[model samples]
Target: MNRYQADVPDGLSRRARSFVRVHGLRVGSLAVEDYRSEWLERGIPSAEIDRVAAFGERWGGLALPPSPRYNGGPRFFTPDTPETDPSGGWWFEAGEQRASVPYGFMIGPDGEFGVHADRWVPLHATVEGWVESLSLTYHARLWAKSITKLVHDEVETIDLTGYVEVPEVVGLADSWWRGPDSLVAIYRGEAECLAFPAARTAYIYSGLDDWGLHG
Candidate 1:
């Protein structure tokens, strides 16, 4: 069995699996019972409990390499512990951030993953989206003939007229779009969350074929 399959639930996408094969760090899973009482006391809904438990069993304690744009990626906490959000939500301390803006990374009650400062800011609708985005990025970097980066106002210059959003990533502030022969990725998580205009960024990957995109 693949390393991810050993503990991950529902499995991962082909590209995501490839990324894990190359960059994933395997760790022991934490059973749902490990955090049951704590989660219950926090008033985490039963449905949310199941989701968080599954995430803990699958990805907890494992750290991926830094995201292509930042100094650190998610480093999940073990046993799926959650802290009550003052905003009347429950959240898990997902990981650390090398970037100075946010207090840290957080997985919100709705499974949205992003950074938490004064409030929870969702970057992607699901943690799986983040993984998928990472996988797509590495794949694009390997196969694209050229890569271009844009920051802040420059991001608005790229016209995505013919591109369609990649649905698998379930993006919020971060998203991916695919054109006929290229892909565009936009990241607005940090900038929007921290109100820091300089943090807006985007990447363009050109000269890719079907194999490079989906293989």
Candidate 2:
């Protein structure tokens, strides 16, 4: 049997299996609340909090309030769309240089269940010499303003490691529902390598030692 078939537990839906197939491995799973706390601990400023708060005030309270039960997880932010065609959004930055990467959350609509955006680079691209090395993509949709009576107020942390064989499991969630799959590689961090997936939200971290992949 393929390693993935062996590693993947039974009971995942077809959609879920498709997700796992596109991405290699499942790193670690956690509740939305846990993910948020980790992001904060990682030094990501609470930029989303301020933005949501300001929006609420400007709009005479938010159409929906932030809820961890629905929307909260590791998030990416972009100033605008990366397409040659212009889309009005935020520009993404990596160190001193800037790229047209999109940034957002990996959460559900009700303001609970997933990830959120902070001031840090949720998904970043790496450059090696004249060529771009990696590309991280993301997709998210709003579920509801709140799910249960309880309101959410935290981000979640999804631990990532290098060496997952599937592309979708490399990052966080699978990108099946999102438009199309995207790939990204991190060459500067503790893991220096490249990866590609059919989805934007998932990734495989291959540690620092093994930087190349071969069949």
Highest TM-score against the true fold, candidate? 1
Relative to the true structure, how large is the alpha-carbon lDDT of every model?
0.77, 0.23
RMSD over all Cα atoms, model 1 = 2.9
Model 1: per-residue lDDT, tens digit, 21-123? 6777765546777667877787777777777777676667665657876455555445456677767877876655656544577788788888777756788
> What's each prediction's TM-score?
0.84, 0.18
What's each prediction's clash count? Answer: 0, 54
**C-alpha root-mean-square deviation, each candidate:** 2.9, 20.2
**Model 1, residue pairs in steric clash:** none
TM-score of candidate 2 relative to the true fold: 0.18
Off by over 4 Å in 2: 1-22, 28-100, 108-215
Candidate 2 lDDT at 44 equals: 43
Model 2 lDDT per residue over 1-215, tens place: 44322142233434333333443332222223433455457644456433333222222111111212112212211111111113322222211112222333321211111122332222211111101111121111111121212111111122323323233323222211111121222221111112222122222222112112211
